[model samples]
Target: MPALRNIRMLTRYTAWANERLFSALGELPAGEPLAARATGSGNMVRTLNHAYVVDRIWQAHLQGQPHGFTSRNTEDTPTLDALRIDQARIDAWYIEYADALTAEGHDEVVVFQFVDGGAGAMTRGDMLLHVVNHKTFHRGYVADMIYQVPARPPSMDLPVFLRDTVPRLT
Candidate 1:
């Protein structure tokens, strides 16, 4: 049950960190997010989009609903503003999801199909942790891309989030 508190903190932190990253990305020079990068996702926007897609997939899994995502990311990249809006909505959804969870519910296993059609199963708490970690990992990718743009990325480290945001690093 104590794990529920950690999950709630982590999900909220994820949202805060995401907002910081989006704010920094939004301030980049014109066309920076779409600028071609050597990464498999092609560009910063696309990489972030990949994270968004996964978030939705896991959300559907938790809700026992079909996500309808055929791929990890869409073929087209959304404008930074549009993606920011979408990410904010999903981030809030995650916060609410965590808040509403009971300890037993958090530990309940949810089975679902992956985007690649592979069958999968994970506990609700584990799924939330995965979602948090996945976004952080891709944010690192985006941070790297941000540096490649010869710009400074927002300081998105967990310590920063803890110190400047909410729910102290405890």
Candidate 2:
């Protein structure tokens, strides 16, 4: 069950880090996130929408349903406030799902199709890990976009999440 504990901690960390990023995003000048940027996803809001869309896709995979997403990001990005709300809700769902997973459940295999129309299979735990790790990677892109605004992004390091939000899993 130690793996289960670690999974729960990771899911919690993912949520904590995302919340910090969203908090920093709130300080951006109006329309700044939507401004053109020379980076991944082209802008802050679109980058975030990419993360959100991916999360939703994985959630649908975990639930054995269709995600209805044809791409990694939507054609239109939501406002920061709206994306924040959606992210919080999905983050909470992952946390609760991770908490409820038993060791056997964590190891269960999930068969899914990638957005590229490729076949894929991963353990439940691996999928969850992907969800967290993938978000962290894109958040790095968002952090870079934040700097384009000549502003500081919030520190969402795992150690910070551990010390300030959830303790390390023993």
Candidate 3:
């Protein structure tokens, strides 16, 4: 299925980009991710955590289960090491899900409740895209925060992913 392949490619790209981002984050000076910023999430780690939370929420939706999240973010800001491990687990799940999804599965509509208690629905493929896009969006915020530290963030462009992670793609 072409659609399943696209979702698989996107999930893999997201995982690769996330790995790059975490590697860059690990290189930041101590406390940089935790340092207070003017952003809504207050700091880089919090922003990243929100993305993780949303990923899990979508994962639950895809599984037709309750996500058990009352908000978009958690109260605790996870340490970089812990967050990396958690994110990696979820990333692996997404990749496996995409790899195993059927041709017709991609177009199946999943009804879900948003964190704000709003009713929502999306096709499985669209939800996967949303998850990847959501991570990219917040990764931008973290990249900006990294810039504020007078540091460089790893280039996470999709072309970079294609060049570095999947050069075999025709």
Candidate 4:
């Protein structure tokens, strides 16, 4: 039960952090994120898009349904506004999914094929943790790109989220 609570908190933090990142991205001049960068994913928007795509893939895996993603990212990237909307939906879904899971459910092992046609299996909780960790990793990429724009990136640190945002949750 405590572990489920932690996962729920982490899921909530993921959603909160994503909302902050999107807001910060909104302040940048149009096309800034689309400009090629020298880091992962080649551009800011693409990096975030990659995170979103992975979120969707893991969401489908969690649901035991087809994810329809052959690669980690789509060939065409959505505009920031569209991507933010979709990302929020998935993030909220993760929060809800976490809230709905029981200790037993969290321990359930899911067997699914990797995008590279390999076998994989993970407990539901571990899969959820991976989703959070993956996004956090890509957000770091975005933060670096934000520095290239000479802009300050919003902080999404878990401690900050806990201190400021988690207490507001019921």
Q: Which digits, one per residue and each the tens of the lDDT, describe model 3 over residues 118-168?
A: 899999999999999999999999999999998999999998888877758
Tell me the lDDT of model 3 at 73.
93
Task: Kindly report which residue pairs in candidate 4 clash with one another.
Answer: none
The candidate that wins on lDDT is: 3
The Cα RMSD of model 3 versus the native structure comes to 1.1
Order of quality (TM-score) = 3, 4, 1, 2
Off by over 4 Å in 1: 167-170
Q: Which residue pairs collide, candidate 1?
A: none
Please, what is the whole-model Cα lDDT of each candidate in the order they appear? 0.92, 0.92, 0.93, 0.92
lDDT of model 2, residue 123: 94
For all predicted structures, in order, the TM-scores are 0.96, 0.95, 0.96, 0.96
Model 3: pairs clashing at backbone N, Cα or C within 3 Å: none
> Whole-model lDDT, candidate 1?
0.92
Please list the residue runs of candidate 2 whose C-alpha ends up more than 4 Å from where it truly belongs after superposition.
Answer: 167-170
lDDT of 4 at 78: 92
